[model samples]
Target: MGVAAPAASATPTDVAPDAVAAPPGDNLALTPPMGFNNWNSTHCRPEFNEEMVRGIADLFVESGLKDAGYEYVNLDDCWALPERDENGKLVPDPERFPSGLDALGDYIHSKGLKFGIYTSAGTKTCNPAGFPGALGHEVSDAQQFADWGVDYLKYDNCNNQGVDAVERYTAMRDALAATGRDIVYSICEWGQNQPWTWAQDVGHLWRTTGDITDTWDSVMSIFKRNVELAEYAGPGHWNDPDMLEVGNGGMTDTEYRSHFSLWAMMAAPLLIGSDLRVASEETFDILGNTEVIAVDQDPLGRQGTVVSSENGAWVLSKEMADGSRAVALFNESDTAQHVGTTAEAVGLPAADAYEMRDLWEHESYQTAGTISATVPAHGIEVFRVSPDGDWAQYPSAVEVGASAVQSEAGTTAELTTAVTNLGRTPAKSVSVDVAGPEGWTIEAGSATTSPALATDAALTTDWTVEIPPGTPGGSYDLTVTADYRSPRHQPRQDSLTVEAQVLVPPGEGTSYVSDLAFVREANGQGPVERDTNVGSVAAGDGTPITIEGTVFDKGLGTHAPSTVEIYTAGRCDVFSAQVGIDDAAGAGGGPPQRGSVTFEVWADGTRVAATGVLNGTAPAQPLTADVSGASFVELVVTDGGNGKNSDHADWADATVSCTA
Candidate 1:
């Protein structure tokens, strides 16, 4: 039978009529709150203890997060006991928090950080353990929270018992005011009641979507929902799209960078939702980008609006307090795309030239009017554009990009680099130079120099690079440098680096793909495994490849949203594999029977084979693809419609047939 929907709530007229009259005048969250929340990475796990909480505060101070404007260190559910005390007051779990909540709050405050706590507006919290919530006991619970020195309150919606959202949320707002403490109020109703329409006068921030999962599809879905509500967000009030999942193990660093950039562009709350205790250096770099954070915390408090979206390319622009515009060129497709927009298009006034600063690269270039970039698949390029007249001092904005080349060992490949002038001024004596590794031949094609290049014009230069014989099958980097003179006759130079892959086909017969080295790989959870099932939680910690009780001696194991590119050198004719969710995914003590993924094979950037979404219970399915004359074959797996929880996928008996 189908599940029932939430019943309509009965309006409570007598509850906090003054609460809905106007928003709290405390001026909290003038910008979206920036901090960390311990729910996405830990859930209700045993590691969510007092010691871990204190460690997070320490990391915030030592890791420069505190200096970067991250203030609150909050706790989610499972911190309270199953029931209230004799006086009907919520109590902290003694075993988990022996020193109690007030002491912990003091420790966080000692570090110059604020303390935030969570409780539901319903009778019970969201977890299956069913902790006490603040339904009719709002007055006492708010007072207890105030006495505990809480600076922020994340009031959730679970077991709401058919009470109106406005009434339940308003009751807490009034009760919090009664405590006379300046507590920031966050409403977590999951947008079921369209909170943005009326939440401006009720709370500091309101969630506009359900919980976010750590996956690419989940990020895109939430962005699509929240990006449309720009009008409702401003100073002291924000439309939340749930916590961030940047450092979680469900997406690549590129995808995580896009996630962070998009959230900053949307001006959403920057509450981190990862375990900072074990976060990697790359994670810290992404979260510590001050330029991006400055855009989110801009006092002007204008949410970015979409200027255009077509063919998986999106352009969003936000006006800053200093009369600058933050433009984001986002690519949602599966391949690299060139996305561009004009300064006038992003609401900037007409000017002779503008300074476009690449937020990710931390470089500034002068552009006549265009703001553009060759965005990678599922990536973003953010630029802060402002009117300027320093064209003579700076070189013309030149964009350089190159196409990947596929060639076998001892073979010659052609690589083309396109240099475009994006500024209002002209470039003179433009010349291109190509460089490669030692013992490798690099020669430029005909017409490597131009006397003069006009604005908005492009100069394409091709170079033939030879791969040394016996070179291993992998990716190699080639650097291209473009030299020119600015309008003021000053010497200028811009350089770009690109990758080229050398394909190593198998011998005259069919061979197992596990024996070959991949040219590129990206996994969701951990590193891709060869001849074994995906690891339990770390690299090289997996068992033999097994799917539905069938063991494969020669195959590969990996997580969803993974891609493993094997070099075929256009000599391979066919590729075959038996693909399915690894049986270990369901057997582990982790969330059982929750594994779901899709398997696909792509030859030379074109999909050749696919299997619809498969769960843990499905048997192994045979897949074959005709990869004739294809230089590379990519084995890809994506999470099912649901979030990525236990998506351990296997490619059993994976083999490729090639000719000598």
Candidate 2:
């Protein structure tokens, strides 16, 4: 299924000066490739063996993933020995793949699945163990992969010895062609060189960003970077923003849904990066959404474009094959927000009404002209809208939003909620209700019902919420519901949920933050550590905290995009720490030490103090912030505008001082 070759180009550059200006004609990956890769969940771990791979293949068939358009089952790094054989051929790790690559490939083929292998364009792979790469051995390695029945190849860019990106990638493209096998070539250059401009005919898909961690910041950052490159993707090639971290435990189900929704909206590849054997039902439900998958695999292969974005609310639209528009309303803020767009704004033909199908909810609704939703924080709502489909009567589009409230234990606080009707028709008998957690009291302070709500009209209610005495300090949810009757007298309802923070002031004097249980914590790489250094990629593998030959006994060790929120209850006055990148990133290193991070302190959502970008080569710097009369203090670490390669950050001797 190769594309027709174009005339040879005269652009003189590196290795392939006469390289054709079209993709490798193998017509693979017409749409973004959907499959599984064993890297994010089990990276070079002992559990990533042949038995595990075989079990994944079985689960794909049993879990309906095979039927969901997932075709490739790929292996990442650490599947091979450190060195090649005397014949200069790559050798599979005997202990990991005792049956060898040929047998494993055959087993995968028998199950109606394709096999994929990985290699770097540099001299060695990215792992610290440094496995053999195919930089100078492209010919022999390509033949080896072809002989082993490989259907796909993910050529990575690590330790490339500063070779030209196009030259290095073009060598492998030509080498693969010489073997006479139709293999999908994936360019993993990490988007450092803007491969999208020239990779149209060189590879099937190109990574537009760095490696993705199972964190919200990582996901959002990658999405922002790749969303702007829609013009570079088409039928045969794609813009891959790395693999899917759907089943990973770092993010919530809502955030994971947003992750999947945005990726599908952008027409990115749907490669599963989590362990399927122990996956939860929610994970399977998110991955097996065929309606969403259809948009990704749509034959038109048009990537969605951002129509409008403001204040963390985004609206995107993708042109479908049947003259429909797949629209997404994404809310990136911490509170529920209303995101809206018109049919004409999405380039759809004018009509009396448009039929909208909720891709996530699998429900159908008719809209006069407005397509909108009250999207939850870090959540997404996707719809497939067409003007020529079965249209039903337009119903009331009620949206709900709430203001956040903070209260001390054993005290009462006021929360305000607003309900708005955005539809053309009016709603009758509209009533509101609020519910709190067990042992908490909720009372309505204003009128909770109205006879009729007209279009663009809003109703507000104030609720008195009480926190129980002696309740632990943390975050809790308040669920608000609105019930109304449509113009046709049909019962309709909508719900809004928001978080409330409760404060439990610490005792007067100084206390080490490591000794306190945080209200919430999130890390980019692994679980946040206490009194130790940010260790390897796995949890509980940390060593003693050491930075610039200095050791600390009490502190927090975490990765980039990390947050640790501690209760202060308007009593804390000072917070201090010695912050820097952990020395372990540079210790026992094969490649150059690579890590960059910035430290920040937030008091009641306000950044009080911060540090510039710090790498492993810099020494620890003292940090202090004034957090007086603040309910909580947030310690944050962010990736320093670069990739999160080795951003192991440490907050040593972290302490907070409180007044009596």
Please tell me which predicted candidate would have the highest TM-score against the true structure: 2
**Candidate 2: C-alpha lDDT:** 0.86
Clashing pairs in 2: 1-27, 2-25, 2-27, 3-25, 22-201, 23-201
Candidate 1, 82-180: lDDT as tens digits = 988898989999888999999999999999999999998888888877898799999999999999999999989888889888889989999999999
**TM-score quality measure for candidate 1:** 0.84
Clashes of each: 0, 6
Locate the minimum summed-lDDT window of 10 residues in model 2. Answer: 1-10
Global lDDT of each candidate: 0.86, 0.86
Error at 406, model 1, angstroms: 1.9
